[model samples]
Target: MSYDLVIRNGIVVDGTGARRYRADVAVADGKVADIGKVTEGARRTIDADGLVVAPGFVDPHTHYDAQICWDGAVTPSSWHGVTSVVMGNCGVGIAPCRPAAREIAMRDLVSVEGIPFDVLNKGITWDWETFPQFMDAAAARRPSLNLAFIAPLTPFRHYVMGEASMERAADAEETAKIAALIAEAVDVGALGFSSTTLNQHMGFEGKPLACRNASREELKAYANVLKARGKGAIEIALTRQVGVLEEDQCELLDFLLDESGRPVTFIALFDRDDIPEAVRNTLRLAAPMIAKGARPQTSPLPLTREVNMDNPFSFAAFPSWKRVFADTSKAAQKAVYADPAFRNQFREDLKNPTGFSNWGRVVVHAVRNPALKHLEDKSIAQIGQEQGKDGVDAFLDTVLADNLDCELTMASWNTREDRMRELLNNKAILMALGDGGAHVDMLCDSGYPTYLLGTWVREKEAITLEEGVRKLTSDPADLFGLKDRGRLAKGAPADIAIFDPARIGSNNHGERRYDLPGGAKRIVMPSRGVEYTLVNGAVTWEQGRLTEAKAGKVLRG
Candidate 1:
């Protein structure tokens, strides 16, 4: 029998923590038809002779909700070897919103996630109002990679409670309505539901995000939606790390787990020097829960981003951040920065000490203007001293001179070497945290999969190639219950990546592009080693360029 496509003579890493082998794979009608060396004729043949063919990477966390509206391929993500992505991960998305709440939702995405308002406003059609309608609108489009979604709790809260969502806890009737909405969303197609209880995630009017105010009773009631379904997962950005959970937080988590009876994965366990106890303490919290048979996991991300004076999200702690993103165009932002009163206010705010990344540590990354070419690689403090100005003036002046286009990169703050090695090797951690489609200009983490393989496996030897591949591929797929897509076996969906093991990695943050709609720019870290990426038995990318194949489907629960 003839097949549609064939990948010949490749080292096969089947995305299992097993031995690697050599094989030829045949694809037909968007599924893996057969494997092992074959002379069978085919419609298309990829000569992947020396490459390592493995299951395509599945990014368990992303925020591509708005970007998917305009960018079907979801660039920077598809640019890497990622074939599947889960969006609406951090409890922020644009559905189940009333018409009056449309502006609120768009601005909320801008403030919380760092998506440029122009990109969100101009690119998104805002076509759907309900969760299922949003799903239908998404499925109608042909994305280049398989996409799944989780019902975001923030919007659901806003939908039912309106202006009072954050002021107080949902009343019993409102809680019931919210639970019903979540259950309906799961029933329609959402994989599960996600929420955040972090104080830092401010929503409308500079308060902690709406979900942060959700009562324990509200969370347990909502999580029961998953219990009713008998399948689904829980994603939470916890109030504190699992190890540092207070009695109230622990009770809430335990209640959710006992009532839902589903996998519970919380956000983040950073291997930080200041928080030396975070890693071990988190594991300590998980041990008893696991013994009692609970699926509790945490994953850290390698988050690096480019910053500029015009980007409001980077230095949001700065008092004038809202004023920075107050306008859409570069000229308008320049006008805001140029105002003497605003500049004085910014100077006052800068004089106060801030603990985040220091401006003295930021280096002038690139200079687009010919006159400013000599300023490249100089620290912002140095530039400030050279210009006889203070830190804020020096940084903002440089950006103003360049029309708010100057990019600055910070010191690689997190991800200590010893810390990443331990975290990557922890089989129980379920490696994740690629905030791909959000924070377009500030951060791009879609390249995490290739970075893990290239840096950890090939160069550092923190983990073996087999284990790294498994972490990137089948591990996440299994955790999310994505059937027949993560492993390279007969009858699985033919989503695969073929790359040179030695060269498969992500480029540095220095690279960027302006391909988003309406000429809005985004930070893009393109992958280096991936040669071919296929989705559903069709070639989507080859040799660092996308082919015109929209073979991906909207995966539903």
Candidate 2:
């Protein structure tokens, strides 16, 4: 028999939480046509030799909305066996905007997701204004991997209300216009709608994100389309500290889920050492809700963000720190640390008790000032003790000494083994929330699938290989309703990642690469042991290089 492609002699972890077995996977016309002993000669054959072949991971959360227009493979994500990705996440994206509103939409993406504003301006073609048109653009791009998107609330608000999007609640007419957009979006194959209440997402003017101004009434107005259609999901970021939720946040969360009548996933429920009660609070709130049919989202792999001192707006998570940095020049922003009164207020905010939760573990990597070289690779807590100061003062002083170019990096902090196991083992909590492609300068969680398998399954023994594969593949695929892509069974789409189980993790600290349009830099880390990645039975990447393959589809539900 003849086939389009074939993989011979590999261990198949079929991504269904089943026992692994030795099999040969054959592909014909982009679907897994056969398994077991495949004696047929194929047009292309991959000798897996001694690797594990699993379904390519379906990333249910990412923000590759704008990047896909310029860099189609979606990079580092496709490099890590992420054959399918759901973008336009976190309520911030570029679409459904008129030409006059384009600048603010671009600014919203730049400010909220860290894509450079110049890069966005030069990179995006702005060929489309509406959600369907945006999807068509991606489809026309014919990226090497499958892509889907959620209609974000931020752009919808911007498209309708413009600058006033943040000034007031939506009036009835605006609500109806927004709902019509949402209906058109889902009707044209968007995965769902995404909104965020996270305070950290600021606009270019440093005000709360436009989505923050979205009233629950308007959201329901839009979400009712998803409910009425009996499809799509809701992605949101709620107000919380680790596991703990404010009373109103919980009410709104339950309201969003109940009213939508579709799966609702909230952003980033983490387990923090500083807030031991945090994870418990979240589980308590979600448990009863999950029992009654609500799905919360979590990431099994921890996150690392490489932030520099000059523009370390990450500290704005602290209220007082945010107030201090409000609308300042770089010099003025740095001066806020020098002012004793502002310093006092900033320190007071450090008592957020739950703030950051991992600053003590932050290591000062490289500093722009040669004089501060001695602090390299030392933890902030250690540097603080040596300087006879607290972590806050030590950090601020170091930033000042380096003239704010210090690479004060936050390494992977939240994924404690026990905590991750608890979250991953929870069937209801989908294994997602990797802010891939969006936080490019600070994070590179796009390599999360390989990290989960190589580290958690192989190195740490926190979970079985089958379990990790299931969580990475079928769990997220089922969550987002991509039934065709997540299993290595016959008749399934031939999206697969082949790797040696022992050597499949990326480096602990990724190096920066200036690959974005306009030579803007982003944190890019390549993974190890992803020997071959096939999208729709076509080899897109192999042996550390990308192939000229574009067989990916823009999947619609």
Candidate 3:
């Protein structure tokens, strides 16, 4: 019998934490038909000698909701061997929105996620309003990678309670409506629900995030739908508030676990030297919850920042910058940054070390300023020493010179090596949270899969190659309930990657590209050693080049 495709003579990892073996895998009708020595004839064959063939990587967190409308391949992620992705994380998606609220929703994404407004405006068709309609539209496009979605709480809350959802707890009626909408979305194939309470997420108008003010009661109401359905997980991003509020976060996780009887994954668990014990304490607290049968996971990577002065989202922590950059035109932003009076006001605000501004560590990263371009690799402090100017003054001058287009990357203060190792080895933590399609200008974390393999497995030898592949592939699939993919098993979908483990590495250094629609620029990092990526029995990417085969599908719960 003839097969649709076959991959032969490769070291198969299988993504099950199993030892590697040399074998051949055959696919028919988009599912794995056989695995072993397949001498049978096939329509197509991939010679995988000297390469490690494993299950395709599953990215559990991404914000490709708007990008998928026009870009089926979801580049950069696809480039790094991610054959499947879960979008609409952090409670910011582009469905279930009123026609008037479309721009409003886009504004939140632009401010909080760093997607350009012009890109969204020109790229998305704005044809669908409800969750199912959006799903169907995405499916009809036939993307190059499988896509799943979650019912974003911010849009649901905003749709039900209007602008009040941005700052206040929803009333009883609004809560009930939100619950119903969530249930409907799940029924129509939304994988689950997600919300964010981090201080970093703000609206375009510089207000609190839409989901930040959600009451416990309201969130519980939303979780009840998942409980009734007997499936789906709850994704949350909350800060560590001590005392009574500490109990609140734990209680929320408990309630969701109890109510949904399913997994609950938190956004991030970072390592901070100042708060040396925070990561340990949080994990220690979560250990018992997991022992009692809960799923508590955190982002595998540290919380890294990419800052661009031209992007409003870069200064999302600063209220003044958010308000100033909200204007769509670059001319308006240039006018504001160039004005001497406005510069004085910004400097004064920078002097005040409020929660809204992070001025001290704002190093100059990228600059079109001819005077500053030579200082690219130098930190603000280093530049200050060379120029005999204050670091803040040098930063401000660069920003003004570039008219706020000067990009800067301020490393997160949390860089404890010990804590990173502990968190990386945690049994309860799932390795994920690569915000791929969003934050285009400021970040390019889509290369996390390659980085994990290269950094942890090869260079550092922190984890074995087998274990690292398991985290990138099977672990996420099992948690998210993708039955037909994620493992190199018979009858599973033949979404696979071929890479040289020794040479796999990430090249993300906060570079900009003008590849998006409307000439909108964003950050991207191309990976090395990913030789071939197959999706649904088709070769979609090979050797850093994409094929025209659009074998991807819209995945459902």
Candidate 4:
């Protein structure tokens, strides 16, 4: 029997944490038909003579809900061989929204996810009103990679409790409504439920996000719906440290795991010398829960942020910055930079935490400033010494003069290589947290997959290549119950990547020009040595270019 396609002469790592073998894989009707010695006639053939064939990476954490609306390919992530992605993370999603709540929800997303509000306003079609409707809309659109979604708790709270969702505990009626919405969402194919209880998450109005105010009881009720359904997990973003008068964050995890009897994953677990004891304490608490059948995992990498001060979304965490910049019209923003009084206030604010969060003591790593273009590698402090101005003042002045569009490099939180290696080696922790579709200007961590292979495995030998592949592919698929994909077995979906293991590396980290709908600017990073990427038996990408094959589907489990 003839096959539709064949990938020939490659070393196959079957995503089972097993050794690799040289083999040929044949595909027919979008599934792998044979794993070796495929000599049959085929419509297309790819000569992967010097490549490693493995399951396409499964990115279990992303915020691609908005990006997928316009970009079916989900760029950067697609460019990195992520065949399956789970979006609507951090309890922020765009569905189950009323027409009146559309703008408000968009505002929350813009502030919380660092997406430009104008981009959301101009780009999203708002074709769906309910969670099921959103899923169906996504299915109809059909992205280049298979996509899954979670029932975001913020919009559900807004849908049921209106303004009260952002202020206080929900009433009994509201609780019931939220639970019902979650049930409906799961039945309609949402993979799980997600919410954020971190203080860092705020709406566009500078108030705590809607999910932050939800009571423990309300959250437990939401989890109960998933418990009854027995099909979805829970993704949460909780502060590592809980203050007085609030439920300890671990208690919430315990409740969700106990009540739902399902998997509970949290946003981050970082490594800091000052917080070494805290990390140990967290692991101690999680041990018993896992022993009792709860699935708890933290993001394997440390949490980091990339800030671009020119964007309103850049100041999302700083109420003062929001107040200063949110209502300023584009023309007015340009004018404020020229005003001396406004510039001084901005300079003064830069010294404070609010301003630091927005525009930190970052160095001018890459600059378009004509005055400072020669000092691209110098820090603002270094440049300030030459100009005889305070570092803060110099940064503000240069940024203001550059119309706030200049890119500055700040030191990130996750710099400890040893801790990163420890996290990667942990059996329980899943090495994901590539916020691919959000924070358009600040970061392009979509290259994490390639970075893992090249830096951690090949170059540094921090982890074995087989272990890296397992974490990127099979582990996430098993965690999320994606059955048909994530393995290169004979019967699995033919979502595969062929790359040179010896030469695989991430492309340079920088910004590229990709015009989204409504002319929105998005930062993207392409990968090197990724010879070919196949999605569902079709060659979707080959030799750094996209093919005509559009065989991706909206995957639901």
lDDT of candidate 4 over 1-557, digit per residue (tens): 98898889988988888998999989899898999888898988888787899999899889999888888888888877788899888899888899998988988888888788888888898999988888899888867888888888999998998888888889888899899988888877788889887777888487788888888788889888877877778888765442111237667777888888778777566454434444456666766655644443444333334456655454444333544565566566656555677656656554543323322335665566687588676777777788898765677677776667677666434455776676677777767778878877666777788888888888879888788888889988877768777788988988998889988878435465658666767777778888888888888788898877777887776
Best of the candidates, TM-score: 2
> For each candidate, what TM-score against the reference?
0.86, 0.94, 0.87, 0.86
Query: For residues 423-473, could you state the per-residue lDDT of candidate 1 as single tens digits?
Result: 777777767777877878766767878887888888889898889889888
In model 4, what is the error at residue 540, expressed in angstroms? Answer: 1.0
| 512: Cα error in model 4, Å | 3.3
lDDT-wise, the better of 1 and 3 is 1
Ranking by lDDT: 2, 1, 3, 4
What is candidate 2's lDDT per residue for 1-557, written digit by digit as tens?
Answer: 79988899999999999999999999998889999999989998999978999999899988888888788888888888889999888889989989998888888888888888888898888989888999998899989999988989988988888888877778999889888988898988888899988877888587778888988788788778888998888888875554566777777777877787878878677667667667767778766566655667766556667877556766756667774567557687677877778778766776667447555668898887878889999989999889898877888888888877788678534556777777767778777776777878777777778887887788888889999999889987876677776888889989999998989887645778998988988888788999999999899999889899998889887
Count clashes in each candidate, considering only residues at least 3 apart in sequence or on different chains: 0, 2, 0, 0
Most accurate candidate by lDDT: 2
Model 3: worst 10 consecutive residues (lDDT sum): 238-247
Better of 2 and 4 by lDDT: 2
lDDT of 1: 0.79
**Pairs in clash, predicted candidate 2:** 243-278, 310-404
**1 against 2, candidate with superior TM-score:** 2
Clashes of 2: 2
